[model samples]
Target: MGESRERLWTRDFVLLTVCNLLLFLTVQMQTPTFPAYVKEAYQANDFVVSLVISLFSLAAVIARVFTGEALKTKSSKILAIVALGFVAIFSAGYYWAGSIVFFLLLRILVGIGFGMGSTTFPTIVSNVIPAKRIGEGMGYFGLSTSLAMALGPLIGLGLLNWFGFGSMLIVLVLLVAIIFPLMHFIRAYNQLPVSSGNAQTVTGIRRFYDKKLLLPAGLNFCLSITYGGILSFLALYGKEAHIENVGWFFLANALAMVLIRPFSGKLYDRKGHIAVLPPGAIFVGISLLLLSLTTTESLLLVSAAFYGLGYGMIQPSIQAWMVKVVTPEQRGMANGLFFNSIDLGIAVGSVLLGVIATHSSYSVMYRWSAACLLLFLIVYFLSQLAAAKAKKAAVASENVGV
Candidate 1:
């Protein structure tokens, strides 16, 4: 039992979690502040602000694919450090971005850094944690991101209100700087063992296109799309709706995730994806529907809780499932494909939802989001059926041999 506990609480896990938390916090801190900044600095419209937000994902998708390939030969520690350093530098530039074009250039640079670091961290975690505890460790690691998403905007907006954008940028810079030193602690844990003889050559990108990977990858894509709408438009929607204390929505959401994730991770480890995933998807669907109907702050807060619980539960479940479906040699590419799916969802959701909001109401965006969830639910159930059938067939083949 001591050994079991120690497996979960390694130095590498702690260091990686801290690094992920700090890096993600920098990104989250800017989410709300950047739109406001673009609006104020360049006198931009909603479409332009949306573009500013979506551009990050656009760059991240391309970078994630390349970064995944690079990890086959490169050091995750060096890549992660360089990525964080770039974030710190470019985030600091938010202070001096006088025009929209310059601000966008800086945002793109930040995206590149973000894509590289984010992809590398998961790959590193896969290396450090014992194979048996991958799901549990990944769940804990993912909480850093969930917590940042929950808190960063609230803190960022408070700082922005008190000290303005320049001060907010400084805080982001400081947060990212913390990762530079902390990264060294993770270096030893980051190295994967080299194969004997020549390094095995990977073939074309088609290696990433495994059929077993498609189910979890599709789930990730849809899940991210659900969140992208909420993250990109929720604040603006709240302001337009005249809801008071909008930050509390994010706070409530974060608190729910913090409360749920550790237990969910343990549950995933003890049970399996089938036990945890269906409920998570259902909760997310309900939350999106609730979000569509909410007008009061109370209803919105409740929606946030539902959404957070669903998001916190489902994301790790999908990741655990993805990792389990691939060989160790292919884990990096699988993770890359998984992250790319997420980026694709976020990119498409932000742009398409932004267009929808431009033409209709923000509430309409949530309603459409509800429809998307219905589609996700159908696909999820079908996939589960297909997996069950395949498992049964394999078992039957073995029984016949017996």
Candidate 2:
């Protein structure tokens, strides 16, 4: 029976994994290209380009808050399908966008679909996987995004070279179209039994925000702020620095993340977050700082390696930590909150960093990123101290009882 259960669980995980990969591929296919498209179409300035990058994140943040509520009342499978349909429609629209305004508008609409679809996968994963394996599973699950991050843009660029931007957009649309049919397989994964009680009840909603979970969520926010800067402006920075083969930097980062994720997941499962998080944080900080100082392409690739390692490790650790502290029934909402925090950070970072870049040099942006990382480190240590104190108190209480 145990073996049978394991097999069933594995099957479910596989299905969810495939779905995540497809969704991430759709996301990545456009992410790196969108800014270039906007720049070319609108002759946009820094602020406008930042807006183009941030619009999706802002919309996703707003959508993430409410997506949890919808998850409770509706079939997540259908919601996912609807979201993918939006992605397909909006992606196709890119081909026909006559003005920068139309492009930006479609990007915002894409964010809405992205928000809904992105949130559902993790929620489904949490439901299907066992509690003990959640961290490991989520770590493995994140590789889907990492993989897409690595390949999607390269593929997009390749398509662009061969066929043009319109053709690349068409390919993305077609890829997105595949997701609707894939929803059938995903339905089985979502069918894992949910708790009988109403998740919408006041008490249930209150329980979703575990104080212990907030530490990781906060960390997620900070980490994403740093990442958002990279994602939104790396291409621009590369241009400023006169770095050739800028796409390789992204590729290197994604490849490093893909290589490191499984190990990081296992480390998180075995060693706890304390063992995994700080080194990763330090590496990330150093990477960003180094990126700020670099003029050469070689150094930029070095920064990518460092950043990728740090980001790959930190992301899964925080995600695992967030889900680990929550109850089974509240996992969806918890995941919702987790993702929303990320969106919030990304949205803010993209907009603010854009403003900063406009006013100053790109190098200053990295300096600011370093400062954010420092702040994150401080918060992380404080959380560790608080956890230690709580542990000591629990030990004392046990001793007293004895």
**Once superposed on the true structure, which residue ranges of model 2 sit more than 4 Å away at CA?**
4-9, 39-49, 96-103, 193-200, 203-210, 239-242, 351-360, 394-402
- Provide the global lDDT of candidate 1 against the true structure: 0.80
List of clashing residue pairs for candidate 2 = none
Model 2 agreement with the true structure over 112-191: per-residue lDDT tens digits: 88888888888887776666566677888888888887888778778877888888877888777766666665545446
Winning candidate number (lDDT)? 1
TM-score winner: 1
Q: Cα RMSD (Å) per model? A: 3.0, 3.1
Query: Residue 70 CA error for candidate 1 (Å)?
Result: 1.2
